[model samples]
Target chain A: MTTANPQTNETVETIHEETVETNHDDHGHHEQPPKGIMRWILTTNHKDIGTLYLWFSLTMFFIGGAMAMVIRAELFEPGLQLVEPHFFNQMTTVHGLIMVFGAVMPAFTGLANWLVPMMIGAPDMALPRMNNWSFWILPFAFLILLSSLFMEGGGPDFGWTFYAPLSTKYSGDSTALFVFAIHIMGISSIMGAINVIVTIFNLRAPGMTWMKMPLFVWTWLVTAFLLIAVMPVLAGAVTMVLTDKFFGTSFFDAAGGGDPVMFQHIFWFFGHPEVYIMILPAFGIVSAIIPAFSRKKLFGYSSMVYAVASIAILSFVVWAHHMFTTGMPKVALLFFMYCTMLIAVPTGVKVFNWVATMWKGSLSFEPPMLFAVAFVVLFTIGGFSGLMLAMTPADFQYHDTYFVVAHFHYVLVTGAIFSIMAAAYYWLPKWTGHMYSMTLAKWHFWCSVISVNVLFFPMHFLGLAGMPRRIPDYNIQFANVNEIVSIGGFAFGLSQLLFLALVIKCCRGGEKAPAKPWDGAEGLEWEIPSPAPYHSFTTPPEVK
Target chain B: MTASTQSNKKLITYLVLGCLGMFGFGFALVPLYDIMCDTLGINGKTATTAQAYDQQVINKSRTIRIEFMAHIQPGMKWDFGPTTNVLEVHPGELVKTAFVAKNNASKRMIAQAIPSISPGLGAKYFHKTECFCFQQQPVDGQSPADFPLVFFVDPQLPKDIHTLTLSYTLYDITEKTLGEALTGPQAQGVTP
Candidate 1:
């Protein structure tokens, strides 16, 4: 741990300045939060809000993972063993909704909340009171969604995509609850995005130029724009589904001059960018981590920025690739196919740059570095499979198959979720002021990496053999592979518990940490103390 | 308010507007999709109404197969199918066909049929001079109703297309029709 930089000394002085300024605030507490539960409820502190988000995401991760366990247990054999078929569908649907909206999106937002202000030398988010509102609304939203399972018809079983006709005409009574829950979630996301954008645009410390800003900040700025732009489109999608089901607006019913396929078009329009939204911040995290562990300045920083921007821009155009089998015109098929493949160029540039940073450098296999390296390799595999699915002719076979399922899990679980785990390990010491048990982290990593592959990898084979997804029962021919995947699924689910334990142990107390826990780490965050001060940089610090 | 606060207020306003605009755009996509499909002859959508045919441009050399299909949407208690299942005709020749629908329910029911043409590229050339799908049909209890269609394949249809399918999916719109009948004209103070 090194704190040799002169900037660190300047930050220590500013901490005192921040304490003086805290007295002027409405809360009237300096370096200490108000007592009890209301401290979390009413507090506008960014770090406190960040903690709430991370814990909420972790809790959702476990709940969603438990639902996944039910799915895998039922599919453990060819016969339906654990739950009914409809219950299985509900598991799959809610699992997807929880993981996407509940776990991944909020986790990224949580990281932004904690790290963005510290990295950019801002005292707090630009809209602090609104930020509190954003965080508070999320739990109520998920509660509405989860509670719908107990309703007469069970929760949404129409899959996370929730294409029309299935979601509208054939759906259950819980459809209204699902729509309302999604609306609330979208509102939370939009407000959170607005807060991020305003903070970055207005609150950067003097001398922190656009080009010099950290990649995490840069990636988040782009992600925030994406959230603002597309979340509303998702709101529009669910609203139409609501109307078509309840109000007879027929926005997606052909009998009323509306096309069900249009629901897919609008959904993927928002959805494709939503995928990038989950991963782009992961890219920023890996970019930050790889350079640190490699003991080198990141290779091609400008190119990394351009690549993220290009990927975001390309996301909007390539949405219809998801609809290749929907009988679109040949021209649309070709257009979407070409546009989807173009995303690979910028994505490729990012992968190569990460490898280049690690090339011929003093690389160490810390927990963070190990996960970052895995993210690069496995995310590329996912990217290649995405390319395969992007081809019009090939997609005709892969559509709705477990191969499609396998592709996304590789990207999301191994790509986005892995980077999140890496970030937790990298900053845990700084966050909790104690190092997590290294042995436990190693065991957690090895178990997850091996089992996740076993879980998702065989699905590609099952799909290639023509097994469909979202079904609890399959032929005896698939029995062996299904068993293996189920075993892997259980193992992967259990491995996450070790992570929870490690976080708790770290928080309770372990090896004390210094100002900078990693020798090669660079940022304004490292310039401050470990367990970053309650209020940092009330008088903004100059970057240069 | 400070200058920064004022600027933040402006940015927030713009972002809120962007969100509202996108919501409007989502609704607008319904019409925009129709217009694009009509102009591009995509999505297997046929013409909204009848189009005229020129007798002089009939292609005598080519014989084309036109297959008709009718389906009753799920939950609709109506028996429906094409009376003339298939036909062989020269391009630009007028063809008359009929579909029969019987209400299985005890009361009269209003239904609408949506028509689609296969080999979507052939859609622009498959002109319906008159079609039952142009308006909703109300069928009496247990009685079969005959709905007629008059159409022609344009002589300008591509040489490669030798066969096409026209399918109609019928949906029960009785509830919607009844609801509209009560509220539509009467709510607007128009007397029948």
Candidate 2:
């Protein structure tokens, strides 16, 4: 309190005066949060909204995981096993939809809701009510999507990409529901992104200039911009698909002078940036965690920021790499191929920065650190495969194959999802006011690291051996590797239960954590009391 | 009202506008992609209308083998095929080809043909001076109708493209034209 400068004092007074006028209950006192279910339903507090988003995301993760279990179970042998092909297609489509939109995105948003304001020393999210609305609409959107599976002719079997004609002329009635769900999800994302950008721009305490802001906040700023820019494009794509299917328009129909391949162009334009949206926040989270565990300053901090910006810009131009087999002009093909390879440079910069941060520094392996380190190693493998797939000639063999599947799973599962686990472990004590059991945490990390690799590693081989993805049955040649993948899938699915238990046990109570549980941790969030106040920074910290 | 709140309001407006702009950009991509493809002569999109045939530009040394393919889009009950499966012609020599369409449906129908040229680099070079695809053809369903196509390839086509395939997909437009007519000058509460 004594460190407050004149500017900080004036800003705090202005914030307090505004808060008093806006929220009567929050007036200069340690007020209790509201009672009962309404506390969550109508809550404007960032922490409450954060909790809702996290719990919803966890529910979706398991639901999506269970679908993956069905997939692995069916693929265990080869020929026609558990579910019908029609239903298996639905499983893959919905599983991807849920994990991408319902699980990973919401989790990052949840983290932003919890961490951004706290890290920047703000009282709350700038637009708290909008934050609440964003979280609440997500469940309904997902509900509409999940319910469509039982409709006549099953759900959208046209793959998550939903390329035209298959989605237009061939898909079932559930296409409408899928479109509606995507629209709602897009709206939620745009609103959430707007809230994050506004908060980061306007809510930082005095002396917290752009450069002084935490890397997590900086990354979210970029991520929020990506969301704002691309989510609407996705919405536009789904709208065109809907019109093409129902309204007799031919946005994706070739007979009406519209190219079905155009749909792929638009979809991947949104999609490539979207993949970066999922991973950039992971970069921020890992950046924060690695430096904390290594007890060293992050190497090339400014360059890390530049690397992320460059990667995001590159994502917009490199979308056609996904469509190398679509028979684009050779020159166009080469352009996309080289641009796709160019992404690895900035991504390499990030990996090197993380390692350099750990180089010759006092390093200890906490549960969070374990996941972060695993993320660096495994995500690079995914990156290498992605580079291989980026070669226009090699992509002809690998396109739509299990190799493509393995490449993305390595990046998404071990890369994005692993970073999420690292973040959860890293921030659990701060969120819960109690240190988690290291024994349980370590078990979750070890089981996940081993089982996840077993599950996704062989997929590269299956893909390499000429096995296409999204098929209900495979050739006898793929039997052994598929078996290993299935067992690994089951074990990895079960391994998450340990994480579920760890989170629950920590929430209830373990050992009471101090305000800053990790000795090496930094940022305004650490400066706040443990469990993070229901309303953080009633008086903003002087950031000097 | 705080200064930051006022800035937040301004900032939110711009961000939301950016969102809307990107949405429009998504739709814009459709035309932009088409235009880019047309200019580059990619995606196998041939010129929609006929072009002037030039005699002086003829290249006698090049004898391009032009192949034709016909497709009937789903739900259109019509048998459609190219009359000549393949033709060998010197560049700039006007060649006449025809597609036979027999409407098998019980009722009379109107059909439109959409053209695509392969070795997309050769698309712009293949000009249609006169083609039945320029207008919808009315098929009476009793006898097969021959739809004439008149075209000549430009000598400027890439030297590597020795063969070119021009494919036409036939679409049933009876319902669409009928609906438009019912809404337009011809509508007098006509049921069929």
What is the iRMS for every candidate structure? 3.5, 1.4
Model 2 misplacement above 4 A: A1-8, A20-22, A25-30, B74-77, B179-192
lDDT for A145 (candidate 1): 99
lDDT minimum window of 10 residues, candidate 1 chain A: A1-10
Top of the candidates by DockQ: 2
Clashing pairs in 1: none
Q: State the lDDT of candidate 1 residue by residue for B48-165, as single tens digits.
A: 7778766666677899999999999987888889988899999989988888888888987778889998888889989898888887677667777788889999888888899999
Candidate 1 versus the native: TM-score?
Answer: 0.95
- Taking every candidate in turn, the Cα RMSD to the unseen true structure, in Å, is 4.1, 3.0
User: What are the lDDT scores of the predictions, listed in order?
Assistant: 0.89, 0.89
Give RMSD (Å) of candidate 1 vs. truth.
Answer: 4.1
For model 1, the superposed segments whose C-alpha errors exceed 4 Å read A1-26, B179-192
Candidate 1's residue-wise lDDT over A1-544, tens digit each? 1333655445434544444554356566546777889889987888888989999999999999999999999999998777989999999999999999999999999999999998998888878888899999999999999999988989999999998989998889899999999999999999999999988887777678899988999999999999988999899999999989999798999999999988998999999999999999999999999999999999999999999999999999999999988788788999999999999999999999999999998999889998999999999999999999999999999989999999999999999999999999988887888988899999999999999999999999998888999988999999999999999999999999999999999999999889898898999999888888788777777787
TM-scores for candidates 1 onward, in order: 0.95, 0.96
